[model samples]
Target chain A: EPEVTQTPSHQVTQMGQEVILRCVPISNHLYFYWYRQILGQKVEFLVSFYNNEISEKSEIFDDQFSVERPDGSNFTLKIRSTKLEDSAMYFCASSKKTETQYFGPGTRLLVL
Target chain B: AQRVTQPEKLLSVFKGAPVELKCNYSYSGSPELFWYVQYSRQRLQLLLRHISRESIKGFTADLNKGETSFHLKKPFAQEEDSAMYYCAFRSYNTDKLIFGTGTRLQVFP
Candidate 1:
């Protein structure tokens, strides 16, 4: 089965530096989303994208976060300036035409 | 706002015994529910969804709209069933998912 793929399974960065997490969603899927799970915490929604634009975003998705579909296959989340609290497991998910999303393995981000 | 809650952070059961992972949600409207599992050293993946109404790996979950719950149950736990499970809910009007704090299910043989 086709699965969502993410690059840089793990990343370590300085607190003030910028970080970009990349994901290639399942082929032919239309909607894409980003979620994060802090250690020992529930997975929280970040943002959702459709038609190359943001459809919805949670309060946690603040000024530092931005998502882009730079290409037909790549969906990237960019944190302009990272904070220690940004460290978490970031997951990328996609669904065909419905709401049932399939998630990627996730990228573990660590900011020191 | 919609929310999901998995009360038990850890649940232990012996092999051949029954298993139930409790899940509850706070949503006024009807919601679609799902249970996702991640085995040791594996990626989080979908185990089952409420709409399918099918049992998988001897596990099944009934969407109790009346109780605002979607608890996952397995008749006989197997050692291989040890994993982390997450309960998620999303409604038709929303594109994002509300995930509960995961529960680690350990089935000892």
Candidate 2:
């Protein structure tokens, strides 16, 4: 079955540096989303993207976070300034419809 | 606000025993419920959705509107069934999914 794919399975970055997590959602899917799970915490929604624009975002998705669909196949999340608390497993998910999202393997981000 | 609650953080069962992972939700409107699983060293994936009402991998869940719960159950579980399970729900107005804290199931031989 076709699945969502993410690049840089693991990443380590300086606290103040910028980081971009990349994801390629299923080709035919229309809606895309980003979620993060802190170690030993529940997965939390970050943002949702559709039609090249952000559809919804959580309070945690503040000024530092931005999502882009730079190309037809790539969905990227950029953090302007990484904070220690930002370290978590970031998951990318997509669905043809609004329900039943398929998730990627996730990119583990560590901001030291 | 919408929320999902998975009561048990960890559950262990011997092989061939029945297993049930409890999940409860607080949503006023009609909800869309789902069970997602992540096996060791694997990505999180969908196990089943309540809307379909189909059993997957010998697991089935019944949506109880009265109790506002969707508990996943499996009879005579096998060792391979061990994994981390998350109960998730999405409200009708939004596409975002609110996930529970998750329950880790360990089936020992």
Candidate 3:
């Protein structure tokens, strides 16, 4: 089965540095999302994208966060500056319609 | 505001035993419920959704709107059923999903 794929399975960055996480959702899916899970915590929604625009975002997705579909096949999340608290496992997901979301293996981000 | 709640952090069952994972929600509008499973070293995947009203892999869940609950159940637990299960709630207003803390089911053979 076709699944969502994310690059840089694990990332380490200095505090205040910028990092861009990339994802390639299922080719035919229309809706894309970014969610993060703090260690031993529930997964939290960050943002949703459709038609090259953000549909909705959570409070955690503040000024430092931005999402882009720079090209047809890629969906990327950029954090302008990283903080110690920002370290988490980020998962990218997509759904054929708007119901069942298929998640990627997740990218673990560690801030130093 | 919408929230999904999975009260149990861990549950264990032996082979051939029955298992039920409880989930509850708080949402004003109509809600869609889903059960997702993440096995060790595997991506989180959907197990089943209430809308389908169908069983998959001997597992089933019923959406009880009156009780604000959607609990996943299985008749005969198998070793392969061991996984981390998350209950998720999505409102029609938005496609974003709110997930519960999750329940780790350990099925011993």
**Candidate maximizing DockQ:** 3
Give lDDT tens digits, candidate 2, residues A1-112.
Answer: 8999998899999999999999999999999999999999999999999999999999999999999999799999999999999999999999987767999999999999
TM-score (all chains, Cα) for each model:
0.98, 0.99, 0.98
1 against 3, candidate with superior lDDT: 3
For each candidate, the alpha-carbon lDDT, in order, equals 0.93, 0.96, 0.95
DockQ of 3: 0.93
C-alpha lDDT of residue B35 in model 3 = 94
Q: Which ten residues in a row have the lowest lDDT in candidate 2 chain A?
A: A95-104
Query: Quick one: ranking by lDDT, best first?
Result: 2, 3, 1
lDDT of 3 by residue, A3-101 (tens): 899999999999999999999999999999999999999999999998889989999999999999998999999999999999999999998777689
lDDT of 1 by residue, B12-100 (tens): 99999999999999989989999999998677788999999989999999999999999999999999999999999988888788899
Of the two candidates 1 and 2, the one with more favorable TM-score, higher being better, is 2
Ranking by DockQ: 3, 2, 1
Error of model 3, residue A76, in angstroms: 0.5
Q: A1-112 in candidate 1: lDDT tens per residue?
A: 8999998899999999999999999998999999999988889999999998999999999999999999899999999999999999999999976757989999999999
After the best TM-score superposition of candidate 2, give how far the Cα of residue B14 lies from its true spot, in angstroms. Answer: 0.7
The parts of candidate 1 lying over 4 Å away from their true place are: none
Give the runs in model 2 whose Cα sits over 4 Å from its true position: none
Scanning candidate 3 chain B in windows of ten residues, the lowest lDDT window is: B1-10
Q: Candidates 1 and 2: which is better by lDDT? A: 2
